[model samples]
Target: MDSGETKISLKDAENEEKEQFKLLHKYEAEVPKTFEEAISETGFGRFNYTLLVVILFPCATQMVETVGMTYIVPVAECDLHLTIEDKGLLNGVTFAGMISSGLFWGYLCDALGRKKIIVYGYLVTGFFSVMAAMSTSKGMLMGAKFMSGLIMHLSKSKAVLIPIIIFFLFVEFHAWNVFMLICASMTIISGILYMFLPESPKYLMSMGRNRAALVVMRKVYSKNTGKPQEDFPVKKLVNEAKQNFTSSRVEMATALKSGWEEMKTILHRPHINNMILASFNAFSIVMSLNTLKFWLPGIFQSISDYQNNHNGTSSSMCVMLGEMSKPKNITSSQECSVVKFHAWNVFMLICASMTIISGILYMFLPESPKYLMSMGRNRAALVVMRKVYSKNTGNPQEDFPVKKLVNEAKQNFTSSRVEMATALKSGWEEMKTILHRPHINNMILASFNAFSVVMRQVFSSLLVILTFISATCMFCIYFARSSLAVTILSAAGTAVGSVPENLLLTITLELFPTTLRTIALSIHLTAQRFGTTLGNAIFPYLVQMGCLPPFLFIGIFASATGLLSMLYANTENKPLI
Candidate 1:
């Protein structure tokens, strides 16, 4: 009888355990799956637009340094007495600096934060740019250029800088030293403006500073919706902070150790292959873009020289500024030539001034929420989501689903540390993930596309040169005339080469998960720098072999990149996984 009673009791306990598990699962199901869903409820608002514009400023500055250098070579050639090798060295030196520092910067940005690196980068880059401007000799300028590249972050400074340089060159302000100084001043102003900008809320949360991230969100909400900060989600954020810590108290040393291990995860599984593909893409793009950008001025000079000789025209036709309207300050009877200090300085000043204004305006921009969530700063991430929703709909904080967001944070982040540990331990698994299915094919395709694009650009430029050379040799019977045709062909090739530059980051970003995003980007950028350095070194030597070989060699790389593109998955419109 006693034995029978004990058996019945055991059956009852099993039933109780099953019921409790059912209840737990039901509760979890009610929670939201991800932070992005909450963020989507926040209407895309002016704040986002403003952020984009602000971010674009750095891009402009980056462009200025990169593309502007090419323009500087020809104009400064007389002043600095640069040879062909010197010009190639100038073009490639900055990339070398970038290669050395890109991985380091990426690692820091991932481990520490993005804002600090970006702000500091601008300051250091500007300082070096000033050094370059004040350079008295070729060696000084080359050193300055390399340092500038090493310190500077990537962006789209070329578009504006190019026009400005051309205009200045046209106006007889071709002195590279003064132009560089002007660029440096603008960069410094930009850095100062970055100081006022808010840290990325995502970065803060990743560091487990949910409350601070929440505070940032509240400020953004208040600024956008004109609402009082009285009804803040303090409870939600507090819970999120709690969830981020696996232990009630993790030591700083332990956390940092974890973070280091976390960085090493990029080399594992799905991420490793992605990293490789991204790096190769970067290499291909940088090679093509820098090769063209750095060589444009030299090509133009060659063309101008050829035309001047063949046409027996004392006036120039091939220079960018020469084609534009001359300033009224110069007499109509005065001979127009590439002046050492053109009115283009005013344009450079204007461009720099505009970038400064943008930097100041961007101070209002917030951090990326995805980055925040990855760091297990769910509460902070939620706050940003709420702000997004509130700003878009002009609604009070109460209207949003705060509890659901909290639940999602709890469920998703409950094992964040465990996941990190898993990622660190299962590096091979991650690699396997990347090597299979959609990712593998995509990587293969993208790599080939990149290879082909670069190769085509290089090959086409050389081919164009050859085609023009043969045509001119057969018809015009003058080497100088052939030089002008080849130079123009080079310009066209450069234009083609740069056309695909804007797509690199977009595609790479969409492919990688948030956890590996920054590191992947760093790897990509580093590879690109390497490629650029190689191209710069090789292109000059190839040109020495009489132009045709350079294009053929470039064509081979382009063909490879292009073939890779065939396998590239359309990441466009796909959500980040």
Candidate 2:
């Protein structure tokens, strides 16, 4: 009787434990999973590697479009009847477009969607690029280039030397138009490729399309894991949308009001100082980099011209510039013409083809899960993460451990549209705030730095080591005995100068809160483009003044900015706000 009672008790305990596990599993099924929990389930895999490859094309095309003009200006000078001033205008016009359009594009990217703007923007930019290639007159070309810059504001540069090599190898045969067409074609290809890409999962969630975002994540998981969508572990996701805007139409008044509020937040106390520092640094670096870079080929061409005419004779940069500035008469017999099978034409074609390939490949990339989390679409974000986990670890989705994620701050906004006049009034009020007290001081400092960096032509030895090296190199170029020495020193200066441009941008990114980061960067880029435009516009005048003026201008500004950089608080391990 005792043995029978013990057996019965053990059986009952075992049954009770099994029943409890069943209840736990059922409860888990009903609970919504967080983005972190979902994403943790997905492992790293082939999809990530593929996404990286696709991103490379747009980057390459941007470089080609911006810097290609540097090469073309030199070769096309005779054909286009370009003077020193005309060359400066052409080189700087692209940046002028960028400066004007940066904020506009940023606004659209947020309101519409990043992928949409990028896609349509690239397509339109390509058309403008083609217009630039076909332009017969200086004004027409400038207009076209400006348009290209306006549309192509999204993307930058260590690969400065590529166009120089390309020009040398190809400009001997083909006209500049062919190269422009090649760039245009690349933009078109990038646009087409962008069509296949999914909208940002975060953007979808922000718009209250949780189910759509989930579908996208499921697709990504399928691609990454080669698994059926039905096999995904999570049966449902948590809804995180804070506002549901019902209207498809967006009013300018509404947009303006919304934008003004965001701008006020960015211009507020804590971020103002960093913004000022970044803007100044951007202006200094871009002005120095582009002004010199745009004119480098011209300098080299002048040197080549002198060597050809004065066989075996050596001269300084100042002497060459002075000689080139003197008037020369051209005869009808000197008419410019294009040659066949040019190397530049071929190289541009190759670049365009690669861009197309990258665009096409980019279709496979998934929306960023982190961006999703930021938008409070934790469930959608988790789905993306799980896909990644499944692909990376080659594990069954159900076997993934994490079942929940922490909730994040959700985006909230009012749906009621305001009148245009009210929006304008509000915007003006916000703008006025930046003109006051603490903000005003930093703004003045930034302006002063930009003005001094662009207008003053001087150099000093006391600065950061790299900038010092760059200054020393510039000084050395004036006294360089051989073409090779000038080439080496100029190249060294250019490479060294690029380091600070990247560093300043990186620091700027780390200095602001997520809400203000994009705006700060936009301001930073606008300052950079302004610097580029002003520097290039003035460079020819400086050259006319003397070679030393231009070199001194670049070297001095570089050093001054380098010194200013020392004052920035260290951000190495600082957490993002």
Candidate 3:
């Protein structure tokens, strides 16, 4: 009778445990689950103190640096006595420094953690900002800028910086946008470094420390934020801790080391193919964004110019200056600096507004579901999915709790070796399937090569044609319009020549995991920054050579980017968190 009673008691406890899990799962998601829900449920109000502080502050600091760097273009021409050609070279060199250090910093951050990486970026960048200001020579400035590149927090920095850079041209003239970004980036970096910053919750959970993940999540997500508890499961988490036991899930000292493990999992029949697919996507996205960003401002300004000319209106701002305001009158160094300061300020603001719009788009994009699922956060993934997808489509017949999945992976699979083998086999099988999927990768690569050949041939002759176009236009416009129109047009042209297009961030979020996103962006942007440096460096020489058509390089880079974009699968409406 005692044995019977003991068995009954044990069974009762198990049932109770199951019931608790069910309750926890029932409240799947409380935060903004849909577009309408975002305003009400997101960190919309100041109540979610932590969320607002973290997200907004980092963004602000990043923008300031971007605005400062981009504004350097206008300033460089005057402060360093740079010709229009020299301006391009300086920008390109600074960007090249950024590209060179990106992967290195990314690896370090992944190895160490986000907190240290971000704080370091602040300290280093802030210090360099002062250094850049103090430099007496162009060489000195270049060295200081390179040092700034060395210290960037690859992943954390990019999320904030990318938007700012993209909008640098638009906001170059807008003070408000520049102010907002600078404030936001500063707030994020400072707040997180000083206090209350928790490490990535998903990273913690992946290593089987469910309790640790819970504690961090609670600390990170304040009650005031109105975020769903489903995003952070206590009992469900405790349950998941039991299931992921294997040689594969062991903890390591650094997340970078973990990345190596992930790479192993990533490669093989399925993941390898996906990695290749991702690589191609990355190649296209990065190249495209870089090229287009370099040329966007020019295109936009050109359009404005065309419209003005068609309407027979004058546009150059320089020619409209007061008769007393001659180069001789503005000979003082301070005067030139003042002009540059004002010019950059206005340009950064326009770009800042556009960047802010992009940020809003990011908020709408959902986080990576595969990442959560891999980490055994099915319940949370489900909640995020509901928020992102439930209203329209792919809503499961009903909420399939994490407990059900966990039990199957642990109990049903443990007794069945065949099932375990199936899971192991699936990883590699997926890779093979991808490569064979119409073999599109090879075809695209070939096409790009062919395209490059044709382009090079045309570009050789096109240079002369471009020079003719610029000379004719400059002749007609300079003489045909009033001085005021000339100044208006120059301002207009600068605007067109600098704005980064939409493809950069859009492709990044779509192609990479939350974990890998920043690194991927760093690599791509690094390439872009280097390309910019080259353009900046070589452009002045090209201009001096007589064509004065500085925009051709920008156009070439953009075309290359577009062509590469065709190699990857379109991420246009695809989910990117």
Candidate 4:
């Protein structure tokens, strides 16, 4: 062969190999994968634990905001000389505030960033809360309470403050003013702690900040395992970033436009129906729980007074060092004196303190990687995975399932412009998709569940009242008084009935795609606030209409909710969109 022919032959061979490699890369990119698949290899570790811990404060604070009023009215009655109207206003005002602002915060969480809303929201909530504590007039107190609810945006979670609420009711510490101050302090503490937490990686990537996401992952890994950033998977992250980072530049206006459209999407298709159902369910749960909670102190006070009168144990009217008067009873036409209990005040203080501690603990956790992946920042997701893998497996990022995760994310690699346009357009299309055939069935099921949950809450409250009435009947029949028995049973029954209430949040989170999750939740919570306010406002009227009608009304709703469960979508083990 001639030298010229040999050189030409070599060049052709090299070119062919290069083309083959490109073809191979394209083929591998088509393989389907998910964020969960990538993250699963990381194993649950310090990252998750810390995240859970940090989230606990927001959860606790939320509970305090919703249920705290129950404790406050009883303790503050003496100092503030509260009227029944004033107490009712206080109970509903926080929820009213939340309902009004929930959409605003939810929009921001989806548009700008989750961390920003959370940090600033809590700080402002704290400031208003302090103003509420220092108020001397009912009008000032009501205004402060309204403002507190307006600015605060709380995260949803279960099992944070239930035990505290129950426990504080039994302790005696007369300090309502101090407790209010403490609740305010917790809000401030959570805001400060949140400042240290990482922004959601999904949010960062969606903004085209791949390098920043990688840096956060390294920081998390170093903190968890005492491992240096040098050992982190820089190469794999960079490669993954190449596949995921869609636009070299994500315009602020474009991103905002996209977010506004995404927010609109939840109100519209497959998402809209589910979103409606979830919101209704939220309405039911919050309304029922708050209605019962706010009404309890008043009912118990009446019960204690009635029992004391019949038993010939004159309830204390003057403040004694160790003695507590039975709760005062008030009728619409009768004038009532201020009544206070030390134990109830102390309970409020303890709950506020615990919430503060929870905020402090939450300061250590990382942002959710699932959120990061959704924003199209696959590299940032990789960094989080490496941290999880290093902490759990005691291995370097190289040993983690980087290839699997990268491959999965690469499978859905649409260009930035196309992706944004699709998201914007998706609002109407997704709603249309949901309205069609099988998906619509799920929406029907969700609606039924929501109605049932709301109705059942009413029933639960009535059941307690019925139990008391039954006990009263027994006492008259056999002269066998069991007031203590009735009280314990009612409290226990109410607590048990509320056990599954918060799971709605988790279920809603799982049911919706990441893009629509926050807005859906926000809508749900806003609906809940509306329900709570309505329930609290109307329960007095319902009671006036007669006890049996209220119970009957709730019974019908609960039955309907149970029947709808039969049509549920059976979403178990399904991959989130």
Candidate 5:
């Protein structure tokens, strides 16, 4: 299967995407895609931690924006004369832009590139933060905040934005204390830094721009340590390129069409019900969790009974305002006491910790490579497989599906090796093809990947109300002078909700194709932006209103949504690799 002489068969049975088997069966397998091979081929090298730093820099900005918004609740309540409903509207409306733009950014990342958009997203988000922070009017502030997310979504979460945004969404409304100024400052720094990182190497290679991929890889490795790459999988790739010979120069329009076709095919399949279930379940969790995220401040405010504690002498809002006006030692001192909304801070801390634990869970779950390979991006698939395998073996490329691997393994055995070696290799290759079999005439994995995001979006709208109500109830508990009750209940609910959010990552693994892992990642992130925009923006207003007298309606919403969440598919047991 030399690149020059590779053959392809697209018989109606194969290209039609029909499932001839009763189940999708897979055994352990491995290969090397661009990034892993680039790293591995440079065998003597240390990991490129520098690039990781670059990749993670945007998080600083995200955290800043989040902290700035969530921590400033008391201050915001006073300065803008914000009603509870106004607060909810501010949170929800600000995020409104995200829903419309997420898919576009993801598609752009796939078509045009990654680094440029990411840089653009970071800088834009930073500029908006500054605008939002300095605003004098609620409308202006909301506009600025919404614009910030819209701008920041330029990079999405494929890199730095992921952790930062997640932190704020899950933590800001509930934490004990955080330095908003420092967080804001960090975001500005990251926006400036993102302008410098190179594109993901795997992205370039899949586009048939090997020279660009090679350049980025060399720089990444060189930054780690000076070394020449060796034991490369050059022959393997050359053969793969031959086998997967779709036109390298396919127009962006056509590629987009193919991507859409792949997306629709999944939604229409028999298992499509799973996609619906996944969406609703995810939505339910998001709605309920955001209940805590968007309104924890109000909930904490009610429960603090600070007035009763100090004989109702001074409002915490006024106290916070005094601290903000003076710019006097806000980080570690008596100054923060005025703004200490104890109940809110405690809930935020609980949720934040839960979010951290969930991220760690992703290690046990491999990103789904089936989606990528199904999308005709085999090179990227191999790269992902290598990562999955390396975790399992010191030598991961031995069982690669290429013929060269089989022949080499045979020769090394001196043919004295039982013919079982060839039989084993042949059986493995056959299974690989079967798992890849077309379904309803479309790439099943790719369909699953696309639907995963769409499902998320669908349920997000429904759950937005759910989150609003839950937080509102917690606020009522706070008002009842039952701070402990509110704290314990909110914490328990958040811990449970956190596991469902992990579905975000899990769903990404379900549908993303191996060849376009980075690209698909970018798209899924955009889908996340969709959730953040609509939910986070409107979130503040919803909870704030519920915080007002008689917020029982909010509690009903959360309870109802939680029950609904139980209806979605349990992707917890999904197999990844």
Candidate 6:
């Protein structure tokens, strides 16, 4: 009887142990996963390195397109019959196109999908770029370049100096068309390669295609991990679509309506002040940077011209520019003088090929998992994270810690179409918001600061006259006896000038909330582009008016803006909303 009792007790204990095991498994299965938790599992490795390489194509292409004209202007002056004003127009036109189409592109990116827009946009830009290369007349080139800018928005960087060096080496070729062709080819290659890239999983989820998003993630996992599709850990995805919005289709009308509503929200209280300030700062910095940058090749060319004619003469930037302002007699018999630099073609070719190579490699990239989470495709995001983890750690996908994802859909809106009248009205309201109350002072300060910075570039020569200005090295540029000294001073100025922009951008980022950060940045970029356009457009006229006017004009503005910066609220250590 005692032996029977012992057996029965042992059996009961075994049963309880099994039940506890089942309960533990159930809890583990039901545990929800957050995007951050899911993504943390993916360690950075081979996938991230590949992504870094691929994204560089867009950046390279943008540099080639926007500044490519600057290189051409100096060499093509004879062929294109370009004047100072015409050069200004050529440089500024692209930005004008960008500004005009900025909102439209933003809406289209939402409606169509980022991948679609990027691929097709690049192809169209390449076509226009080729057209620009083939243009015999200024008007045709201008139109082509403008169209390129209108279509191409994925474009900036310090790497601009690399192209400058390349152009310098290649300037002797005097093959402006060839240069343009190179730029076009780079853009086209990028567009073609973009075709092989996966669409944004977030966009798919936004359109109520969570399963499609998951499929993309799984493919990414397989590629990153060198594993079969069947090995991907996550098999199920949560539905991210709103109950009433079950369709997987997105219309232009829907996008526009949503965009306009979002724009309105961005322009309202709490955001207005930050936006205005940020925009103004962006305009100033970009304008200053581009105005000087676009004209740099021309400036160097003029210096070369001056030095060639008067070999022993040492002069200031004003002297070179002053000589450039003087009218010249040109005859049909006069040969088009090209800069005779060595190995320029090779460098330019290298720069061009780099873009193509980056594009081709871009084929290996996957959709952004962060975007997936935003679209409420948590499961898809988790899969991507797992792939990243396995690739980074050389582990199996099943070993990924997170098993299920928590829905984190942030975008929810109801709208069908947008009307032209509504767009205009909303734009006006946005402007009003920017100009209203506490924000107005911020705008004024930012605008003044921007204006000041650009003016500083224009009157950089004014360092000679303003004894109070602390930049003694800049003052030395005017007095420098040798080319080497002048070069050093100029390099120093370039390095120092870059600092203010970084500070202002950081401040802008710190002052705004994450929700409005992108819009604020957009505002900043738009303003910066506008500044570039305005500065380039006016720079030629300023040069023509006389060296002193440009200097004085910029000097006073810079001085005033420097003071205005004093009133700006300190952004240091301030938490973003």
C-alpha lDDT of all candidate models, in order: 0.61, 0.72, 0.47, 0.59, 0.50, 0.67
Against the true structure, whose TM-score is highest? Answer: 2
Per-residue lDDT of 539-570 in model 2, one digit per residue for the tens? 88888888778888988888777887776765
How close to the true structure is residue 33 of candidate 6, measured as C-alpha lDDT?
Answer: 36
Per-residue accuracy of model 4 over 240-305 as CA lDDT, tens digit each:
332322445334465467668877887677677777666666665556555655766655554455
Worst 10 residues of 1 by lDDT: 471-480
lDDT of 1 by residue, 163-221 (tens): 54443344333457677777777677667667766787666665566666666666555
Candidate 3: clashing residue pairs, number: 66
Q: What is the lDDT of candidate 2?
A: 0.72
Per-model TM-score, in order, reads: 0.57, 0.70, 0.46, 0.56, 0.53, 0.67
Query: Which residue window of length 10 is worst by lDDT in model 5?
Result: 22-31
Models ranked on lDDT = 2, 6, 1, 4, 5, 3
Cα error of candidate 1 at position 572, Å: 13
Tens digit of lDDT per residue, candidate 3, span 144-235?
66766666443554454454445444422323223333433453345334334565545555445555556555433334343543443333
Q: What lDDT score goes with residue 346 in model 1?
A: 51
Give the TM-score ranking, best first: 2, 6, 1, 4, 5, 3
- By TM-score, the better pick of 5 and 6 is 6
lDDT score, candidate 2, position 560: 71
Identify the runs in model 2 with alpha carbons over 4 angstroms from their true place. 1-27, 40-42, 152-174, 242-255, 265-273, 323-328, 331-334, 337-463, 570-575
Candidate 5 per-residue lDDT, tens place, 285-304, comes to 45546545666555556435
Where is model 1 more than 4 Å wrong at Cα?
1-46, 110-112, 152-174, 231-235, 238-282, 310-520, 564-577
Cand. 1 Cα-lDDT: 0.61
